[model samples]
Target: MKKLIGIDLGGTTIKFAILTENGEVQQKWSIETDISNNGRNIVPNIIESIKYHLEIYGLSREDIIGIGMGSPGSVDLENGTVIGAYNLNWESLQPVKEQIENGTGIPFFIDNDANVASLGEQWIGAGKGSNNVVFVTLGTGVGGGIIAEGKLVHGVGAAGEIGHINVDPNGYTCTCGNIGCLETVASATGIVRLARDMSEQYAGESKLKYLIDDGQQVTAKIVMDQAKENDPLAIKVLDKFNFYLGLACGNIANVLHPETIVLGGGVSAAGQILINGVDHYFQKYTFPQIRNSTKIKFAELGNDAGIIGAASLVKRQS
Candidate 1:
């Protein structure tokens, strides 16, 4: 039987998986990303790793249907090149598709990492069974993907940029050179920033303030945990985060009216509290019809979404 290969390329690690065409994983592993020399070594290392794994599994290039990869940056699908992947030190357009196809002698496919994750969710996770879905990832930075009518939307190759949505015109500057992008207020770093700002202005007793004074590294997790314990400062910051996140969702729903909006990433691990918090404001801004139709849920696949989603690229075409 033919097998499928999935790769999720990140700044730190490259996750790999061998899967059946049906989206079932047979084996999975990872390697540290060799981002040295302007990321020149990255593709070579991936080819070598895949070759080694193929040997171990007693499989050859012909036995695999295709290889799929999820990468960072703006992807040129027609050319299979990624642009502005600064984190990978890829200063210029990298011919990821050409290089991988040449090295592996197999068809290769690639998409934006976040978009691939959305495909993964839609295949077998939170967005399963939904023809239209939106996925928002709130981590160190925010990322997003949109699927409609059971297909990924890639309008001009920049369609699913949910992070860059301006939530606060007067909010802090985002790395993307924008003011108050959702990433600045809804991401993990954003949450911590909110905590620090609120603590300084807060006059009441706050364990969050005490922790900061004690030199404890205050993280988004800490903020959520503190809120769970009813810390006033933490609660205020979380409420703020939810407010922006909900507003973004409300606006997105008004346009797409997707069947579901799935939240993923490390910050989403706050679970029900995060969902409930966002839902409160989500209900306020959304139109009554859209509000009643859309549902916000947490991602089920977690980190694996990348691998599965990449593989689904090939599965989708097959």
Candidate 2:
């Protein structure tokens, strides 16, 4: 059986996996990201790690058919260069493809990390069996990927940015310098921000209010927990979040009419509460016909989505 290598590169860690051509992970490992010296060591570290793992597994370079990678930045698909990844401290274009191919002597491919994760979920997770899918990640910030007819929609290299969808005209400014983007109110940070602001103005008795009064750090999880416990303030914050999130997804569905909109990321870990809240507004906002066809669900692949999706890149070419 032919083998493939997958790499999910992030700011904190780089997840590596060896998989069969069919996308079954055979072995997986990770290494801390080295951001020192303007990230000059990043690619070299990846190269060395792959070499080490290959030797330990008693596999030769010829055993691997191809390598696929997901990186955090704007990827120049034609050139395989990552442009201006602030988290990786890459202020300039980095020739990731050339460097990795040279170091490994293997056919390599790359794409945005979120894009690959979306591909992964579509291929085998929540969106499996569907040719069209949209994946939204709600974490520190919001990220998204869109796959239409089994192909990634890379419109001008930023097509699937679901987080930047304008949901509020007078809401908070997002990190992207836009007002009322979904990220400002739907992300983990966004949820906390809403809770804090609402708590100050709310006179109602709630756990969130008490927590804030006691000077405790409020998190998205805390807010969700409080909401679950019937805290009025937390529920209000969650309602606002779900309203914007459902609104965003509704608009996206109206445009793409995808089979599934898979939700993932840290905030998504809120599980049923998050989905239920979003679904309520989603049902309210989506087009009548679309509401019947487009379904929203949690991603099943979890952290492994990136690695599997990266390998799918090689599979697509092969």
For candidate 2, give the lDDT: 0.93
Q: Give the TM-score of candidate 2.
A: 0.97
Off by over 4 Å in 1: none
User: Candidate 2 residues 182-240, lDDT tens each?
Assistant: 99999998999999899889997888999988999889999999888989998899999
lDDT for every model? Answer: 0.93, 0.93
- Which numbered prediction scores highest in TM-score against the true structure? 2
Q: Distance from true position, residue 313, model 1, in Å?
A: 1.1
Backbone clash count for every predicted candidate, in the order shown: 0, 0
Candidate 1: minimum summed lDDT over ten consecutive residues — where? 309-318
Give TM per candidate: 0.96, 0.97
lDDT of 1 by residue, 102-190 (tens): 99998899999999999999999999999999999999999999999888999877888899999999999999998999999899999
In model 2, what is the error at residue 85, expressed in angstroms? Answer: 1.4
